[model samples]
Target: MSTTTYPRRHLGQGDLAVSAIGLGCMGMSDFYGAAEDERSLAVLNHALDIGINFFDTADMYGVGSNERLLAPVLKARRDEVVIATKFGNVRAEDGTFVRVDGRPEYVRSACDASLLRLGLDHVDLYYQHRVDRTVPIEETVGAMAELVKAGKVRYLGLSEASPATIRRAAAVHPIAALQTEYSLWTRDVEAEILPTCRELGIGLVPYSPLGRGFLAGAMRSADVLDANDWRRQNPRFQGDNMVRNLALADAVKALATQHGATPAQLALAWLLNRGPDIVPIPGTRQIARLDENAAAATLGLDAAVLQQLDQLLAEHPVAGDRYPAAGMAMVNG
Candidate 1:
């Protein structure tokens, strides 16, 4: 029971309208650190209670455990939630990274496996987690189109794809959304990828809209992260990079204070103001943090504040690459 209601935005020109802010469910199962199933289940229900219906997950998250985690919730709230999950990024049983697989056969099998794990007949939106460089975009999207024909997926999306690849894929089928890492700190998509998406009538779904919690003004030091947390290995969260980024986070905090909002709210508000077609899914395992983030949907920012944030980030540009070399190679393919 939420006193504040959230507005829905259509992902592209399609009839698929979801909450303005989505919940990214990756960290709850893996990547961040250890998490309790009971706690994660509570957060999922709480999200729906607070008017959040867009749930983003992927087959690779927790090496499939993440999809299993959502099965019970999806079963109970089948009609209320618009579940979006991804495929293409393959992983081994021990959680070792294999390779990006966009082969037609793999695409079909992956969708079946994800549906089985999710306990759902069809997913609202399905994405190719990463572009498989070895395979042509046409071949990969062709298989995805088949899924849509069979009612396995309502809409199709592409993540971390290059502008050219996006064009090629959209030519084959209408791309409902483009999920990329976008935030005040990560604006690489703005240069070309975003324009390409807009040109083709595809909405933008920004994952890690809070810079993977960096822009939240938390994590004063890299040491604060657990030993097994994946952020520890991220280039931006290590050594001198972490020190420099903390200053940027503090600046965001000060601006948020001036606007009577939390740093996470300010960050998400900024993205919400970016456009009506852009929806950002910020991940959190804590109910309090989820509420704090969902509130950003109602936190409005005027032109002056938006310009000020733009200037602050411009003056103090973020340090370090977004990912390590191996991981970086997979994006923008």
Candidate 2:
């Protein structure tokens, strides 16, 4: 939401609607670097005030610190926005490593834990953060459908799930959205996932739409990353891969200049151009940067310019995989 509503995008199936752009809350608590809770809370409030009704978070993000962080900000306006939280990535109480779990009993308990963390009896949308291959998708989604029937969750989602698994889960219950890594560099979704979602009327929620801050032109070098920064562990951002990828970023920056848009805006605009039903969620803990990202809706792109971008990006494909070895090991697709 902005001075204007940006626009409404169909999320899953019949009757569901959300802003053209959503807010990814993962970085507000952990992963990217140390988070500024005070500033992050302000950003969340600002998002709601601007009409950004779709707010995304996960159970493992901060091991529930993210939901707890949203407690103060969402307490008064809980009903105004679509609060989407995820489960499946289980953590030990010590807050160390997490593993995927889609056991039926675990699903119920995890949802309950998320509810307690958010201080809400029911979540607007609940997603399985990752597919647990050991547990059938039917079992996981069946447990999720029960939550809907029991009034604990309004809608369901799956993150990084394969198209086949998505269809299998949809057989249990209609999935409102599929959250996945989707950016210019991460184009694998276009070949299978996006088409399957379109055919089934499931909305595509693009996470890391800014290339995880790479498309923003803020990260110029691997050396710019703090020692603890997760990107440093990413192959695409390591060693020569780091310098090689900047050429692609430079192309995006050039296109942004010609279009009178920021590289971040160009990146988001590119995703929005992919389909009307797609919503790009870029995470930010700074209010000014949040506003800038939201403003991407105002910067539109026509067909010819979009094709030009496609060709340029195609010519200068990014180097490195989107995730590190351990992280890549969990993605369903």
Candidate 3:
């Protein structure tokens, strides 16, 4: 168990209570760039010490290397964390995303493969990483439900799933959480997706709650990112869009300065204030950044501050799409 004290929240009505801020482990192994395993391990340990028990990873990340990376930590502290891994986003051997697979056999095989990689018997929360439009949600979730019955998975979830798909999945099984990209810059969820989750008693897990580090008020240009850094390919981080988006980041920085909090902290605190059902999984490979993000749980935003942020975002709308054209097609399925 974590020694440090922190506020905990449940995912939906399930008994899986995790720290309000979960560590998204995708960057430790893939996407962002090259990272040392030793550094990643240290960061993971520090997260546990700081009372962050929820760790998120996907099987396709690093082409299964991400789950493998967490194996050692899970082996040592199996009972101390609420580990969540996702599937459905298939990848080829060359780390190229092949397609989204939600077939019944693929679901079973994927869970088994993830367990084999993690060297674990069961997963606490298993999510369909991306909804497979090729397959019916009922058949996909039914296969996930079978995993629950077999004691292979404790809770089921869906990532980037539409509200209609969410309803369909919940009818098949008790969906614990819905992981989606939500942050200060990406308020698309607020209008419909968020309300739908709340109505159905499914907790909201906001991925990229810091807007892929844009809301952190650091990256002034896409030129700053490493050559292989995936953010470079992101529309929001390119050309004129980046210029316009920085203005929003500047506004966030101004408000954060007034509140005496880092922009990342203020951004996260804003999401936390949205409701108790929200748990933002912000990814970081550095322990310092991890500590900075974890402190957001304690950063309180008054009604006036919240109102200011609301108006600020409303006035300075984000510039570009959250993802590229192909990536955008996968979400809200």
For model 2, where is the 10-residue window of minimal lDDT?
A: 1-10
Taking the tens digit of each residue's C-alpha lDDT, what string does model 1 give over 227-323? 9998999999988898888888999999999999999999999998989999999999899999999999999899999999998998779999998
lDDT of 2 at 242: 81
What CA root-mean-square deviation does each model show from the true structure?
A: 1.1, 1.5, 0.8
Question: How high a TM-score does candidate 2 get?
Answer: 0.97
Q: lDDT per residue, candidate 2, 1-333, as tens digits? A: 235455678788866677788899999888888888888888888988887878999999988999998877678877667889999988876777767899999999999999999989898889999999899999999999999999999999999999899999998899999999999888999999999999998999999998889989878887777687788888988888888888888888998899898999989988988888899889998988888888887788998889988898888888888887778888863
lDDT of 3 by residue, 104-180 (tens): 99999999999999999999999999999999999999999999999999999999999999999999999999999
Q: Which ten residues in a row have the lowest lDDT in candidate 1?
A: 1-10
Clash counts for all predictions: 0, 3, 0
TM-score of each: 0.98, 0.97, 0.99
- Native-to-model Cα distance after best TM-score fit, residue 212 in candidate 1, in Å: 0.9
Candidates ranked, most accurate by TM-score first: 3, 1, 2
What is the Cα-based TM-score of model 1?
A: 0.98
Off by over 4 Å in 1: 1-4
